[model samples]
Target: MGDFIDVEQLYDLAMTYSVKLLQALLLLIIGLIIIKRLTSFLRKRFERRKLDPSVRSFLLPGISLSLKILLGISIATMLGAEMTSFVAIIGSIGFAVGLALQGSLANFAGGLLILVLKPYKVGDYIETKDHSGTVNEIQIFYTTLDTPDNKRVIIPNKELSNSSLINYSINKTRRVDFKFGISYDDDIKLVKDILNNIVSSHSLIIQEPEPKIVIGEHGDNAIIFYVRVWCKREDYWTIFYELQERVKLDFDQNNINIPYPQMDVHVSNS
Candidate 1:
């Protein structure tokens, strides 16, 4: 009789645990389906917001993982696991891992900030203090750039987020600045007229702002004229080089002397 009672008790315990395991399995499957649908729904909404591909790639997985973790906790509780102890263990593991990869975590956060805020996007021509290039790819930990000379440069995303960069391609039009210095003896009016003519003749230059031509400074060797012209961003380099060449040629024809640095010394016999 004692043996039979022990067997019956063991059988009841086994059946109870089996039922809980089945319930846990069912919950896991249902939770996964819900997570999938939710992820899909969010992706479509992100597309409507026109979020960058990098941002979506980083965010979707994070969201899915977080949801699955919560589902796991729920399933574990259903399976008779103590919630407090389980959460505490997970927290301890996470804290240790975070400490081990602190720098990586910081960079990861920086990349996320960059992707969401968009100070500069891929395809933008950006200039940093030590680097200038066209952005080719923006990733979670780093970014790739193709320089004007066709060199590929990889930069840490943390640096990009922390530093100030100039995005030349962000605007449709950009102002090209030029400083031309001529001998103080040259006719200021003639120089101004020549600059105005050159700027007006350029087909790429925009007219709404009107070119600025004015005497800027009187230096030891020359008088400077500060010239500014607005042009389409695509035409900026072309207009810049063309204007310099035209100015030099026109100045030569008009006998305007572009001054160079010189030293004047008086020799004394003492």
Candidate 2:
């Protein structure tokens, strides 16, 4: 009878431990789900606040991951588990992982720098390392650019922030300069007048600067005229394309000859 009682007590103790283990697991799962939902809610709230997209992308993911880890640790403690040893183990592992991912960490830091610096905004036209494109999106590791040829290029934030960046849309207006050459025989005054008339007639051209046209140079076979105009940034492309077309047509109608390269070839017969 004494041996049977001891066996029964051992069995009851095993059952109690198993039940506690199961409850701990359930608590962990519920905690994770709640963290997920709360993180999502915070993200949406930040978005509604019109936070910078680049900032929000990294901020939300980082905060959520941190919160989930903390909650999991809390749940573990409630299950009467010793956490100090586990935390020490995680700390050592994290140090090793961080060393292995140093380059990725550098990129993430660069991305944060870009978000804070505000060198260029979304939809801004920029040139970096000879690659010209419009910024489509900025992310934690990389930035997306849409090229003029409709190509999507992903550039690492590390390179982007480190390199020189040229932003074209920084100002509300931009200057467009065009040089046209005419036959030396054409009157310089007449050429200037034609360019001036065209500039003034263009609707997109800004009048404050008062477009300037002057004789630039006298080439071997032609005379050059420099035409400078200013227009709004949004109208830059339209003004550029239209001015080229109109200048060619007007020059032709006025009998102005844009010089073309001519080579004199000599053949010798022996």
Candidate 3:
């Protein structure tokens, strides 16, 4: 009789827990769907505010993770866990774990600061003392970069946030500067005209700023002509290299002498 009673009680307990488990499963699915919609809505709102892309990339995942944690706690509470005690236990455990993983926590903090300050974003070409690359991703602990040579680099958030960085792609337009030195005997007006023609011929160079070509300084062996031209950021290198090559070829054709450093030293025994 006792064995039969035990079996009956076991069945009762199983049925009772099974119902709660099914309800929890349904709640979990519905909660996830709601979270997805909520996150999407928040993303649109963030975009409307014109928040930085890096900030958006960093914040959305954090918010979703937090919401999901809360959802989990709610489900646990519904399964007969004490809400207040459960939260307290979680809080205490998080505190302990945070203390244990202080370095990781610092990296997380640095990542937050980076997102908030808007130093650089994904697709921005940035350079540091050791690394130079286009930013590929920003994660909680590290930032990934794709170098010009097609190498991938992973930098810790702590090091990146603390270091000085140059963001080359921040501005819409970039200035390409060139200093060309010609022999003192070369005709200045002719050289300037050739440079102007070169600038005008190029489709990539912008016309609004007006290409600057003028006598900059007189070097020991040559007269330095400074050239400054503005172009779209992506076209900067193309314009720079092409102009240099064109000027060299044009100068050779016109017999406009490009002077090299020469020192005339007379050594005599007095």
Ranking by TM-score: 2, 3, 1
Best by lDDT: 3
Residues 55-136 of candidate 1 have per-residue lDDT tens digits of: 7756787789899999988998898779899989889999999999887788888888888798888789999979999988
lDDT of 3 by residue, 1-270 (tens): 999999999999999999999999999999999999999999999999997677777788889999999999989987989988998999999999999999888888889888878798988999998999999888787888999999999988888899899999999999999999999899999999999999899999999888898899998889999999999999989998999999999999999999886789998998
Where in model 1 is the C-alpha error above 4 Å?
A: 1-91, 264-270
Sliding window of 10 residues with minimal summed lDDT for model 1: 52-61
Q: After superposition, which runs of candidate 3 have C-alpha atoms over 4 Å from their true positions?
A: 44-51, 136-139, 144-154, 181-193, 200-225, 257-270
Lowest summed lDDT window (length 10), candidate 2: 52-61
Alpha-carbon lDDT, every model: 0.90, 0.86, 0.92
* lDDT (C-alpha) at residue 174 in model 2: 96
Task: Report lDDT (Cα) of residue 235, candidate 2.
Answer: 96
Residue pairs in collision within model 1 = none
